[model samples]
Target: MIEIKDLHKSYKIGKNSLHVLKGINFSVEEGELVAIMGSSGSGKSTLLNILGMLDEADLGTYHLDGVEIKNLTEKTAANYRNKFLGFIFQSFNLINYKSALDNVALPLYYQNINRKERMERAMSYLEKVGLADWAKHLPNELSGGQKQRVAIARALAGQPKVILADELTGALDSTTSYEIMNLIQEINDEGKTILVVTHEDDIAHMTKRIVNLKDGVIIDDRKVKQVKALENV
Candidate 1:
């Protein structure tokens, strides 16, 4: 449900331009779980940002669900982001004062969903993530794994077409990382497309396909046997 062709991006330094992505091309079908793996400075984050519509590419084309993504007004981009993309960051990115339930409901609030339905949907997602009992807990009150689970719930609350997770398991211990990946796998099984950006080989193996990036270009891309996270957990 996502397509990109010869994508190019660059950033200007003091006097020199730093190229971040070069001639990138790939496609992700609906319901596929893919991992983008690269070392630091390999342009994985830049690719994810462009895919999420958080940044613009300097060249080439991107199509999400058949709509060409280029030159979108800020308002339109925000609308499309809310309607089509859900993001999970390594830092959690939760408001410190907001409880897990409210944090999950935040996106729905932006969608103008009413309080009752928002809470209902939020609680259901929290339940789906196995965090229903901790719904009222604030981020500070939860452990690292719990916090990521809350983040996952928040990501799913919108029911977006694709979920983009950036280093989702980076901060957790091995056990917790596997747990989070298990949840992500379950979500993909239900037909939501997902793209995870991670450097860890084990984490990459949890996905059905891996795209390896180096020096701002995709160096390798292939499908592999899916390693079920629950087995590791």
Candidate 2:
């Protein structure tokens, strides 16, 4: 469902350019749960940003669900992002003042979905994440895990073709992380293509495939025996 060929990216630092991703290439099929692993500055997050169309690659190709992603007008990129990509961040990124349900409904607002329908869909996703009971609670009222769950529900409300999560479990305790991974596994089982960017070995092992990155290049790509997060939780 996603393809990248000879992807290269760099950033300008003063007069010199820092090359971040060097000739990265990979394809993620529909319904696959893949983890991209790397240490800091290994280009995994750079890769995720490129995949999410948050940043353009200096040179390379990124095709999402079929369309080539390069040189897109900001407006068009925003449109495609809403249409095809869902994101979960390490920080949860929930608005402090908004209730869980409203945060989940924010993306739909951008899509021009009406209020009633937006809340309806958002509530369904909140329920999917087992947060329907907490829908009216504000982010500050929820715990870290709960906030992340709300973020996941918000991502789901967009109904994106692929979900790109960066360090999704970084902030939570092991039990909470495993619980979140269990939720992710369940989502993947239901046919959503998912990619998680993480440095944690246990987190990576939870995915069906692991792609290792070092020094801005792919070092290893292999399918692993999936470890059930529930068992660990």
Candidate 3:
């Protein structure tokens, strides 16, 4: 559902130039779960930003769900991103003062969805993430894993075509991380595409395909075994 070809991105640092992505090429099909693994400063997060349309490539193409987005206006790009993509960040970007349900409903508020309906949908997704009872709690009131679960519910509330997650389990303990990963795997099995960027090998193994990045280029792309379910583990 996403395609990138000869993607190049760079930034200027005074007199010198820093190249973040060097002619990167990749594609992700509908319903596929993919992982991008790289070391620190290896540009995997930069790639994820480009894929999520949060940042633009200096040169090359990015097409999402068949629309060529490289030439879109900022307004248009934001609109498209809201409609077609869901994002989960390593920090679990929830507002400190907002309750879990409110955070999940925030995106819908921007879309002009009415309060009652938005709350209903948000609650449904919170239930899906096993956090319905915790919906009234604020981010600070919840544990790291619980906050991430709320973030996942928020991402799901949009019903977007693809989910782009960057180090989703990075802040959690092993057991909690496994629980979150299994939730993502369940969503993937139900037909949403997922592209995760992680440094952990066990997290990378959760996907159907792995892309290893080094020096801002794709070094390896291959299919691997799916991660066993948490129950199985």
Candidate 4:
């Protein structure tokens, strides 16, 4: 469902250029649950940004669901992002004043979905995330785990082809992190393609495969013995 080859990226810092990704190559098939693992400055974030179309590679190619992602106009990129990618960040990124329901409904609003359908879809996703009763609560009213659940629901509301979660459980306690990973596994069980960017070994083990990054390159990519999050929870 996704493919990349010889990807290279860099950023200019004052007079020096800092290379972030070098000759990166990989592919993710439909319905696969994978984790991209790396230490800080290992380029996992840069790779995730490129994969999410939030940034472009300075060299090489990227194909998402078969469409080459390069030189896209901002409008087109936004359209593709809405149509194909769902993002979950460590920071919930919910608007502080918006209720959980409205936050989940926000993407559908951008898609021009009508109010009735948007609310229905939003509520259904909230239900899936076990947060239906808290739908009307604002982010400040929820715990960290609850807020992240709301964020997950929001990501799923778009029905994107792929879900990209960056450090999704980084801010949570071990129990909550495992709970979130269980939700992710449940989503993957239903045949959703997911890519998680994380540095935690246990978090990466929850995925079916792990791609280890070091010094801006993929050092190891292999299938792993999947560790069900429920075991930890």
CA-lDDT, candidates in order: 0.96, 0.95, 0.91, 0.96
Per-residue alpha-carbon lDDT of candidate 1 for residues 1-233, written as tens digits (9 for 90 to 100): 99999999999999999999999999999999999999999999999999999899999999999999999999999999999999998999999899999999999988999999999999999999999999999999999999999999999999899999999999999999999999999999999999999999999999999999999999999998999998996
Judged by lDDT, which candidate is best? 4
Question: Model 3, clash count?
Answer: 0
The lDDT of model 4 is 0.96
At residue 183, what lDDT does model 4 achieve? 99
Deviation from native of the Cα of residue 39 in model 2, angstroms? 1.0
TM-score of 1: 0.98
State residue 153's C-alpha deviation in candidate 4, in Å: 0.6
| Model 3: residue 26 alpha-carbon error in angstroms | 0.3
TM-score of 4: 0.99
Order of candidates by lDDT, top first? 4, 1, 2, 3
lDDT per residue as tens, model 3, 85-168: 899988999999999999999999878899999999999999999999998998999999999999999998999999999899
Q: Report how far off residue 32 is in candidate 4 (Å).
A: 0.6
Worst window of 10 by summed lDDT in candidate 1: 224-233
